[model samples]
Target: MDINRMQDKIIAEFENLATAVNKFSYFRHLKKISNGSQPMDPEDKNDRNLVTGCSRKVWVTAYKEDGRIFFKADSEHSITRGLVNLLLKVYSGHTVSTITNTDLYFLHEIKLFNYLSASWMRDFLSVIQRIKSLAIVQHLDAAPRS
Candidate 1:
């Protein structure tokens, strides 16, 4: 699905839940997606990709495939892992322009910012920034050297 649709879907899912308990319940279900993502290898979990400021260790790696970005992430915490999975689902398999240009309002619409503490939310925002930075670097690398 396109990024906007995916964002809408996430918002809808969270909107379906009326209470904090229900939201947490739905978040637990996101673990299934997290479990299905590829695990980060020990070598891939180095400090370069390790997301700092999070309560738990979260590592992310990105590469370009067929002009689209792909991401791999691993986190010690299930909720963080699921958040990574959610981001990968939206940004992966999309071109750099799409990745960098897309507006990520779903994060707020889903109330993730409200649900998570300031530090945890910062970690999540950092993950998004890292993803965009990787996309920018990849885009520059793919450009023809003049």
Candidate 2:
């Protein structure tokens, strides 16, 4: 029921996961988003916006679009892309406040933290925080006066 449990279940599903399979999965997510879904935007059109925490070449972009926070991401590896999809499914479609305030401790409950080393964990957390901050700032900017 919690993010931790849910993450464990998800991990169990991927316990035998090969990195190559993850690569293919990212392509699947991209195709799915490209078909009709709105993927999160990368922060820049250039190489500057790319996320550095990932094992592969990854880019994550976030924008407060409509009433929802839309995230578009891409990775040079399939599994990493799948990871992005997993993050998107959990983090997207919520309002900025919702995303910012939610007990993301659920990720810990899901055991999503084990695979990474400390540095990677720090970067990953930084990425999540950045996305939340961008969404919150955008929302405040767009809010109408009472």
Candidate 3:
């Protein structure tokens, strides 16, 4: 599915949870599922992939295959990991241009900022910046040398 549709589906899922606590619980559940299935490789935890702004240790790595970008991420904190997983669900398996250009309306649609601490939000934005930076690098690398 496209990014917007994926984001809308997530918003609908979150909307089904009536309370903030329920939404938070859903994130924890997502974290558990994400960790079980896609544990980050030890090599990917290096400084090169580590996202620096987060108080919790977070690592994000990106690769391009068949002209689509894919992201894999892990975090020391459960909520952070879940949040990253949420972003990965929306942004992964897309072209570099698509990833970079898309406006992340889901963040607002789900009212995520209201639940998270300022520092956590900053960290989350850093994760996004890292993803976009990786996408930009991939675009540049793929460009024909003038």
Give the winner by TM-score: 3
* Stronger candidate by lDDT (2 vs 3): 3
**Residues 68-122, model 3: lDDT tens digits:** 9888899878778888888988889999889989999998988888778789889
Q: How high is each candidate's TM-score?
A: 0.85, 0.59, 0.88
Which is the better candidate, 1 or 2, if ranked by TM-score? 1
Deviation of model 1 at 138, angstroms: 1.4
Best by lDDT: 3
**TM-score of candidate 1 to 2 decimals:** 0.85
> Which residue segments of model 3 deviate by more than 4 Å?
19-37
Q: For residues 47-127, what per-residue lDDT tens digits would candidate 2 score against the true structure?
A: 665765544566767667688776776665554555556666567667876778776554554345655557646656656
Residue 24 of candidate 2: its Cα lDDT?
47
Q: Cα deviation in Å at residue 108, candidate 2?
A: 2.3
Pick out the ten consecutive residues of candidate 1 with the lowest summed lDDT.
17-26
lDDT against the true structure, per candidate, is 0.82, 0.59, 0.84
Error of 3 at 132 (Å): 0.3
